[model samples]
Target: MTDATSRDGTRSGSTAQPVGGAKGPDELRRQIEQTRGELGDTVEELAGKADVKGRAKARAADLKDRAGAMTVHLRGSAGHTVRGGAGRADPPSRRARHAVRAGLGHPRAVLVAGAAAGVAVAASLARRHRHGPC
Candidate 1:
């Protein structure tokens, strides 16, 4: 099998040429400059990836922008529902109201629960009647 690496240690398919290969001085200088430029680009890319704080800041800025857009959209649709933490009421009344609204939305579930309770009471009474005061 053919060797994958050239004699100068560069990979066969790589853009870099062998250091002491048969080429003119101007061509060699151009190749060296091109390799340096490619190396600089690679180093910049790696440095950007290594910058955790910068990446976090960028991600935070993106989230803030998205949240601002959503807030604007919500405000346009329903101003009353688009409340911040400025003047919220206590949790008890808020939770009670939410529960009441949910109960109203699912009448069938409430009816099913009431029916189940009635069935359990009737079964207990029948058992007591059959056992005759025991």
Candidate 2:
């Protein structure tokens, strides 16, 4: 069966077959099922993309893991430095260099940490300003 054409020349309904010839009913049904499955997958992908909270939580978890790993590495390095045969502590600049090296692999975590530190500093300044001289 052929599809009915609307006033604007567009074909409508399931009976419309591709250019070659009319498709068997079974073939049409199979095509429809496949198309539906593909559409469902696309919809699911779009839904996942739309889930902002889920994405944010995943990102936070990832950053947290990276930060934890960096902390452990820094702690191990610090312990090694402190235990060095010289029997003296490393300078602050050396500790900072260790931190920067640890942070080099995870730029996002470093950025988030820096932003958090900035926010903390701003909050501290705001509190001091609010109380007027202290």
Candidate 3:
């Protein structure tokens, strides 16, 4: 079987080089600007063809219908959640408070509380020093 190397001693799968050097940053920026200008013109042409008043009315009706549907869905979901949550022995408010207390009991929470206390103490000391030991 023949090896994969080409007749020119380069790898057969390698790409051929471009005729010119790579484009510089300024040329690249110009190309990007040209493309953006063309795209902007295309968008403006498309926007001009649309019927503004009719489109606005249709969009407003669509949004209103969607909002009404969403309100009904959320109301049903909230009712279900409240009913399900209420069936538990612990009341929702008490349960939430207990959860918050438990979270605050963690080491990270204690560390954050300690840091805040330290800042407050330092600020108070600085104020006392500034006011000549009030």
Report the lDDT tens digits of candidate 2 across residue range 7-36.
Answer: 665567875544444278888788789889
lDDT per residue for candidate 3 within 1-134, as digits (tens), equals 43365555544344432333238888767767987999999998888667698778888999999999999999999889878977556779998999789877797987888899999999999999899876
TM-score per model over all chains: 0.49, 0.49, 0.33
> Per-model C-alpha lDDT, please?
0.82, 0.86, 0.78
Which residue pairs clash in candidate 2?
A: none
What clash pairs does model 1 have?
A: none
lDDT of 3 at 64: 100
User: In candidate 2, which residue ranges exceed 4 Å CA deviation?
Assistant: 1-22, 90-134
- Candidate 1 accuracy as lDDT: 0.82
After superposition of all CA atoms, the RMSD between model 2 and the true structure is: 11.3
Order the candidate numbers by TM-score, best to worst.
1, 2, 3
Off by over 4 Å in 3: 1-49, 86-134
| Candidate 1 residue lDDT tens string, 1-134 | 34366676665654444645637888878878997999999999999999999999999999999999999988876645445445566589898999779889999997898899999999999999999877
Residue 24 lDDT (model 1): 88
